[model samples]
Target: MAASPELEGTESPAPRGPRELRLYGLNAVHAAFAKRPEAIRKLYLVQSRIPALQPLLAWCVAHRVGYRVVEEADLEKLSGSAHHEGVVADVLRAEPESLSTWLRDLPAGPQLAIWLDGVGNPHNLGAILRSAAHFGVAAVLLPKHSSLALSGAAARVAEGGAEHVPMVRLGRTDNALAQLRGAGFALAATVVAGGRDVFAADLPTRLVYVMGAEGEGMDRELARACDLQLSIPGTGAVESLNVAAATAVLLAAWRSRRPG
Candidate 1:
């Protein structure tokens, strides 16, 4: 396996924290309530926003989750975002299940999924997940070393999408890949160059799409582990699309080609 020139910059100065993560904004909070209300630890809202949040509040109260009325400044301080729309909640981490667990849970037939090899930006992670959910991707997998952050900002940027997608950590061991392949998935690596155009290529019924992180592209080893590689045919207007943009386009193509 070849070393990635991109791996050198993977180290970050910022520290990571425990599993509990704070989520802010009305859309994110409401979506969480709809999908996984039990995960909510606490809720904070501006008194002015209370009238609009009655149903949500009622649900929270009935479920025994605590809520407190706070000023806008307090809401801002609580969420670390001015765009929080006067709501924030501390919730359990939404980390997804292991590859084997996902495999065991399959209902039937063909499926589609994605793996993020070295994606760095949280907003991009959130946006990619939103696209994944839109195209019915079963889950989004990331390597243990990936710098992707499942943060409050990410959930906010995802609008209501954070509640729908499953995000998991599947490292570079290739164990997950082997299991997926044995289960009949054809893993396709997406590259900026040196592959057939995705628009014209044959796609498998069970597939996993691989994308490298921004600025540094995919790890060479991880890319080589895939069964095949494909590229999005683009004009020379720009060198490459951001990882999130490419992911959305590729997923759209996958959806468009189905036998619906």
Candidate 2:
């Protein structure tokens, strides 16, 4: 939630837009620029990164966007993270879309999505976004009460995956389920145990994988409501794989069965 580095007196006023976010890391900044170049309000980078970011620099000069060449330590201090990767940008945060809007605009196909029941870790969310982008996931469904939102660390960890995936806000649980069912999507609850093996199960064409939190797991009522319960087979080595890793595995399984 930290804002980007403030420009000195030399810079002009930032353009009005959505909430601003400080995005460090080369790939994260690059992705934001590639997706919405106009959203970039200000930029700060070490001299060494200039060559790789020549296009962006050219855009900044043409548009009169504020940019500064500072020392590595200055970037570290400004971004409040050592992983700035010699570049940082102030960009407008992409807002989440309502369920109705997303559903209305979604194209019909063998689409895939994930419903985050209680997954809250930013790193896990980033990893899930990365996997979701890799597997062509349509949207990330967030529950009504969920507090999850895109953050600087999550974007950095996603390695540009965040730009490709849209976070969608769900309505009432039952209503959301009804809408998805009407859209020809099957809900599959991913449980730690007592479920059909993912590798052997007959996956649906339009499927939404419901993932729960780490310790408390999915809500009992929600899990029971799903059309199918799925579990990844493991040797009971250490309870289960992390939620992000499990998501990647489940998505891969689905894609393998229905390759495009």
Pairs in steric clash, model 2: none
Itemize residue pairs with steric clashes in candidate 1. none
Task: Give the per-residue Cα lDDT of candidate 1 at 7.
Answer: 21
Model 2 residue runs over 4 Å out of place are: 1-18
Give one digit per residue, the lDDT tens place, for model 1 in 21-119.
888888888888889888888787877888878988898879888778766766666666688888888888877677778788876776888888777
Name the lDDT value of residue 38 in candidate 1.
88
Q: In model 1, where is the ten-residue run with the lowest total lDDT?
A: 6-15
Please report the candidate that would top lDDT against the real structure: 2
Q: Model 2, 44-129: lDDT tens per residue? A: 89889999999999999999998888887666765667788998788888888988898899998899999999999988998999
The TM-score values for the models, in the order shown, are: 0.88, 0.92
**Model 1 TM-score on a 0 to 1 scale:** 0.88
Error of 2 at 208 (Å): 0.5
